[model samples]
Target chain A: EAGVAQSPRYKIIEKRQSVAFWCNPISGHATLYWYQQILGQGPKLLIQFQNNGVVDDSQLPKDRFSAERLKGVDSTLKIQPAKLEDSAVYLCASSSQGMTEAFFGQGTRLTVV
Target chain B: DQQVKQNSPSLSVQEGRISILNCDYTNSMFDYFLWYKKYPAEGPTFLISISSIKDKNEDGRFTVFLNKSAKHLSLHIVPSQPGDSAVYFCAAIWSNDYKLSFGAGTTVTVRA
Candidate 1:
């Protein structure tokens, strides 16, 4: 079975610039999540979607970050006016409904200078 | 606030020895706990998990123990191998929202 897929494994941008990351979840998965892992820290939940509808996004930076899952299969996370602290590995994961464990992608490493 | 915490930043053990990593959580609502392993430049992979209903769950050489009263959980790896060298993270989720909360992580190294 294919695991979650994410494009642009690495990205470099300047502070105040905008950047976007994309992810394709496993087939038939109904739940998708985006997480951010800063250096020496664990992945922190940024947002979650349940079939095109947002389930949770309390930790998301409303002013600078946004994400959407179109048609409930693929997702895109965007950050505008990126800051130096925003530099981190953005990971995408997915799981079937009612399942506890999730499958994760290799992740996109973003570097904001 | 960070709910789950792995206080030990790093641990080193001899090959074939035992490795124990600890985690503590602040949220009582969190009923499910999980462990994930990550290599440099790679995303975390699910390792093992334990539910609130049970005190212990074992998977092959890996075992997880949960103490509800203390809100603490631990992972034990017996006969650790060199391949087990990586950063280990502890995560928690409350059934209500299913949002995962994670700790900073504990780096483990196994020497040959």
Candidate 2:
């Protein structure tokens, strides 16, 4: 079976610029998630979507970050006016309902200069 | 506040020896705990998990032990191999929520 897929394995943007990342979840998966992994840190959940409806987004920066999952299959995460601190790897994961384990994508490493 | 913490930033052990990584959580509501292993430039892969109702879970060479009363958990890898060197992260989730909260990862190095 194919795993979760993400595009633009690497991205570099200047401060104040905007960047977007995309994710395609595994087939038949009902839950999708976006996570950020800063250097030397574990992945932190930025948002979660349960079938195109957001389940949680408490950690996302509302002023600069936004995400959407259309049709519950693909999702996108955007950051506007990117800051140096925004440099990190953006990971996407998916899991089936009532499943405890999640499958992750390779992630897009974003570098904000 | 950080709900999960891996106090050890790095650990080294000889090949064929046991490697133990520790993690602690501050939230009692967390009922499911997991361990993920990650290599450089790759996403974390789920290793093992234990529920609050159980104290230990074992899978092949990997084992996870949970101390619910102390809010602590640990992962043990026996007969560690060179390929086992990677960053290990501990994560937890509340029973009602599917989202996971992760700790800072611990880098493990196995020497031959």
The CA lDDT of each predicted structure is 0.94, 0.95
Q: Please give, for residues B18-45, the per-residue lDDT of candidate 1 as tens digits.
A: 9999999999999899999999978789
Docking class of 1: medium
Checking candidate 2 for backbone clashes, the offending pairs are none
For candidate 2, write residues A1-113 as lDDT tens digits.
99999998999999999999999999999999999999988888999999999999999999999999999899999999899999999999999988878989999999999
Question: Which candidate number maximizes DockQ?
Answer: 2
RMSD of each: 0.8, 0.7
Q: After superposition, which runs of candidate 2 have C-alpha atoms over 4 Å from their true positions?
A: none
Question: iRMS of candidate 2, one decimal?
Answer: 0.8
Docking tier of model 2: it is: high
By TM-score, the best candidate is: 2
